[model samples]
Target: MTKAWAEEILDWNYEPPYDFYNDNNKEESMKELLEAPYFAVLNDSGNLAGFYCIGYAAQVPLGYLFGAYQEDCVDIGLGMKPELTGKGNGGSFIRFVLEQVKGSKSIRLTVADFNERAITLYERAGFKKTYMFAGEEMSFFVMEKRSL
Candidate 1:
């Protein structure tokens, strides 16, 4: 992702409950986004639709202790523009992302258990919960999709 796009993503703010996904540190977030395993997604109108990251950037450190990511899978992390959420666009967006990572035999992602909307979306996208672990304040589930 470009610095400009990363800056835009860092500025996005979500409502309560989802606000935890907001970026609090621009410097650190920018560094992560511009580094490897990160990419920006744009819509047909060329607007920043979302962003995704692979590997370590996609995992929660605490999950490692619980053996949540021991499987051979492509771990992915993604977020949509706050304004675009809950508008019936998630399925297509996720499908597009899965297509991008279709080369992988298996894909994995971690999600907050409370975010049922996201969990449902992932399930619809063929991701099944494989493990659950507690975070500093909440709980997270490690979901995976196999055979592309």
Candidate 2:
């Protein structure tokens, strides 16, 4: 169910060093959008703190979800208001994503190697390194968390 505080979290720009699903790839973007299930956080006053999008549930990532493994695992993307970063909000947000992703083989995601802060948060959120992929343009860490 969409929570009362969810609206505040609903508005966000997930663009960054990784730019997880943005306007750049318009052709395939809408397809991914359809697959996302949103989760929101509430403040003490019951206002929304932030939100994230988890893809690959009954929801599909356009067609991206199909090629990347055939099980029930989800690919996660999240953001807090830029002003709310580094004070542990991100860690909690990631934990929230993990909670939503609970069950199945595992959750998978790619992180730019240079984004050490995010990498640390992922590690704290129980993500483990699965592989490293690099190209002339960038390098990333392929991380996964096995389901209990």
| Most lDDT-accurate candidate | 1
The TM-score measured for candidate 2 stands at 0.62
Residue-wise C-alpha lDDT for candidate 2, range 35-147, written one tens digit per residue: 44755556578656665666543222333433434445667766566557667778667776677667766787766778788889888888987766566665667677778
Q: Which segments of candidate 2 are over 4 A away from where they belong?
A: 1-35, 46-48, 56-72
CA shift at 54, candidate 1, in angstroms?
A: 1.1
lDDT of 1 by residue, 19-112 (tens): 9998888888788888868989999999999988888999998998898988888989999999999999999999988888887469999999
The CA lDDT of each predicted structure is 0.92, 0.60
Error of 2 at 126 (Å): 1.6
- Judge candidate 2 at residue 67 and give its lDDT: 44
Q: What is the model-wide C-alpha lDDT for candidate 1? A: 0.92
Q: Relative to the unseen true structure, what is the C-alpha lDDT of residue 132 in candidate 1, on a scale of 0 to 100?
A: 99
